[model samples]
Target: MSQDRDEASAGPQPAEPERGGGAATSSGPTDDDGALAPGAIPEDEVAPRSKSRWAFARELTVIVVIALVLSFLVKTFLAQPFFIPSASMESTLDIGDRIIVSKFTPQHSPLHRGDIVVFEDPKTWGSVPQHRSLLKRVVNDSLVFVGILPGGGDHVVKRIIGMPGDHVVCSLACSTKAGPLTVNGVPITEPYIDKGSVPSTTPFNITVPADKVWVMGDNRNDSADSRFHDGTSHGKLGSVPMSDITGQVVAIAWPISRIHAMKDYSNVFAKVPKP
Candidate 1:
């Protein structure tokens, strides 16, 4: 009776829980405070972070590729950027000025007489070929191809003075004593010509042929334009083929102070009758 009373005082022993199937396993290694230890995250948890990083990288790549393609398409068919390398079109487009040319003008829109055009070198036009290291050329070409850099060297920009079938004439002694440039027998007043410059120092009379145009620069005295190339060795290299035109200068794109839409001077050519 005493022993039974003592056992009752000691209280009953606790039952042992079953192992294996019913056992509770820890999710991962833990520190003293029961928080997951550094680098002790489960493989499944870590995999998601890795996958997210890869996904981000892939998405960025896709976006960059898409942007490049759009830029190329815009440059190819919509518009392109160019920088003035010389003073040929100065006062209007100074050296180091950047401009945007619209391909739509040549492709879809009717080109007007006063339009400023960009075209390939019709007869080399006295442009000296630049010598560049192969690596430099590759880098520059790639940038130009992608529309990230403005095109230069192989193209020239000038104002169209005579379109197809126009009888253009610049009178004798093309110096300070030069005569007014007449188109279709009408003298056109040009207010865009550079200060202290004459119409031209070289005189010529030529009727622009079909699918060709006579172009001149705003800086008349400094420009070696259609007049200089009028009677080249290649014969009448002054007239640029319409097919060679890349586009028309639509706006000045750089030199924030000079940012403005290009003027076509339609009124200047308004009175000149079409041939």
Candidate 2:
């Protein structure tokens, strides 16, 4: 009995640990009172995460600024791309050929004869419009967006054959039957006409209206240019407005070997007779 009492009373029996669920806590600094202190984070886990987020934001901002600056530059003075879709100017510019056009020159300079130009298609050039694919658009726009790719808004490139206020006639009767175009009754020699295409077939002569030009393709037989669209003495058919002229092709930039500056028509037109 004594031994039993000694064992039981030797120390106050440890009270059964109170049964309860585990306590919820976030790792943080402990206060003097042993409670979590606010605003304290473990450096091991949170520090790296915070640093990563900050770095990511900074990088994103830098990339956005660079993109904006590049876009502005591209839209400004830099070279831009345009694709040839038709064979109207064939043998010189083929389908799938990409050319670099001079946007700045045409704005300040006069459009000269023989300048291979890209223009906003006058309703006279026909209804077709050129454009690039979605993927191509994304790539082009992401790099630099001067204008829409695939050349939106009815754009076509052709050679300028006649200038304003000139009496322009095709198939001037040569010895046999017909010859090249006659401006003011004087024959102008065209050396750039596509290799095999003849001078002219359909004949129509008209004085070009003021502030407008008569355009024709080098591939005379294969092209439907101002000559084909001209209306009879009965009515007016195809005539491009001077305002629709876009820009003259300054050079062929791509396919490096073929890269060469375009020959200005001024040299040839210098010899043409004035009305």
lDDT of each residue in 1-275, candidate 2, tens digit only: 99998898897777563334322234665678765545445545556777999999999999988877765565455445678767778788877777877767467778776778777777754666547899966786555353334342357777877777778776546312356677777777888777877766666777777777778788777877777777673113455677886667877766777787776667777877666
TM-score per candidate: 0.81, 0.68
> For model 2, what is the error of residue 270's alpha carbon versus the real structure, in angstroms, after optimal superposition?
1.6
Candidate 2 C-alpha error for residue 7, in Å? 26
Cα RMSD for predicted model 2? 8.0
Off-target runs (Cα >4 Å) in candidate 2 are: 1-69, 76-79, 125-153, 172-178, 233-236
Worst 10 residues of 2 by lDDT: 17-26
**lDDT, each prediction:** 0.85, 0.68
Regions of candidate 1 where Cα sits further than 4 Å from its true position: 1-43, 48-52, 124-127, 232-235
For residues 11-86, could you state the per-residue lDDT of candidate 1 as single tens digits? 6789675555433343575567766544355545556777899999999999999999999999999999999999
